[model samples]
Target: MTRARRALIDLSSTSYYHLIARCVRRAFLCGDDKYTGKNFDHRRRWLVERIKLLSSVFAIEIAAYAIMSNHYHLVVKVNRQQALKWSNNEVICRWYKLYRGTPIIDRYLRGEELIEEEQLLVTELIEKWRARLFDISWYMKNLNEFIAKRANKEDGCTGKYWEGRYKSQALLDDAALLSCMAYVDLNPIRANMANKLEDSDFTSIQERIKQLQSNNVYVKSEITHQVKQPKSLKPFGIRDHARTLPFSLLDYLKLVEWTGHHIHTEKNRHILKGTPNILKLLKIGGATWLEVIKNYSNHYGHFVGSKTVLRAHAAKNDVSWYKGVG
Candidate 1:
């Protein structure tokens, strides 16, 4: 059956996603070419920094990622609960960091002097940015467009650098989330780009490793169960100083490292046979465990296709087109 690029995702249903974006030309969009020999390592850094910066603006928390020669992967959790809590003005204030809006927007977001009319305008503008912040399409568009413009200027070329559209998979549960994260972190090992996850350059795994060692990480040690959850189904807190379960922060980091080693190589493949232990760590039922493992096939861009039924989606994902249709 034919399918559109993306089926509509019930945003409220899932707060986490696995997103992938690839270059237009499959050849050397990211690596050093043997023929022309142009390098794009800087471009990879551009993406990483941009990802990190965007996280600061939006309520996105990046769990894992890998940037390859022609493509990149991201395992991000959208804090919809937190994002929805922000006042309309707070949303605009944050978005204006990545994008430049209008003159009134600058004054409003910056806390500068404003006319009574400007105050009213700011109120209305914030409403718009607030709405767009939760929409993944808007999030991706903002990220892609910024990078594309900068990249085009640097390469002295114009037109599309990205493929048709970015792809995303909603993680049905924790198994899907952790496994996909491992898949992303192990991308370098699978491609022979790096012998181990620790050495993978320009990857979140590497950045995270550095952060872990240097103690630059912002991950809170308090588990959600211990700390008080916000009163709202949507959290009233913008950034919670709490962590997920299995409180030993030290143990969790070790587990993440061990997971990286598990799928990294042929000779070391046997080291990951502690099925019961692994399952226990991720906290999943055996049936759910097997189902998630089955989804990790080679057919669909290194991970299973998303649950989104593409049939009900639009023909294209262009923002203007979507607005017109709506």
Candidate 2:
């Protein structure tokens, strides 16, 4: 059975979610089409810019992302509290950037005076919009819809751009979060699109690498870039803030490098050996962690985590099963 979005997204349990959106008919709409020799690679830049712009407006923070030929992956953290803190006027102003908003909101923004009743009505509307500003559904909707419209206009044709509703997987624990982040960051390498981390364009890994190099914090074979984290995406941290990722930039780089080497070797060798210390610190075994980073969606369902955490989440949602888990 297809579960409802409400059932899948439970912010109280976890705010991090892995989202995937693919092009219609699985076409290479955002990359170079070998068959047609059409260079659509520029479209990826459009997506990255739009996503970042939307992130700036919404309370959602992007933790990791990878823009591929026909699809894109994102790990995002929702900050409901941040949205709740905004004033009614501030909410209206922010929403107006994406949409014209209701007539009442328009008038309010135009500096037109409102009566006591009218002010009350506008406040009601602002309240709803405020909630939407923090909503993942609304955020994804605005993102896809805007991109679709722009693409259609550019293509001089109208039809479906995205295949369907974006697929989402909730990260039930830190293990799931870390695994999914690496999976997304290493997608280009896995697909053979790029052979190196810095070569992986339109990915968060490359973005972070560029930032580190620019600041001179990352020198040859040294992890001096511990203090600096990507500003656009969520910072990788231990406990500086509750919203940050559960590891530092240096730790993540090491883990990714180790994972990339193993993945490349595994292509030729069926078995993998050795363990990354970071995984040990997180209490995740090498083989299990490799399985997760290689095939996250196949190994887990709507909720990704250990059996214990999965069971707890299923019980909380009153679900008899989640992708065949009790």
TM-score of each: 0.71, 0.93
Compose the digit string of candidate 2's lDDT tens values, residues 26-106.
Answer: 447578877777788888998899889889999999999999999999999999999999988889888888987788778
- Candidate with the greatest TM-score versus the true structure: 2
TM for candidate 1 is: 0.71
Which regions of candidate 1 are displaced past 4 Å? 1-7, 103-122, 215-278, 281-326
Give lDDT tens digits, candidate 1, residues 211-239: 54455443324332223321111111212
Question: What does candidate 2 score in Cα RMSD to the true structure?
Answer: 2.2
Best by lDDT: 2
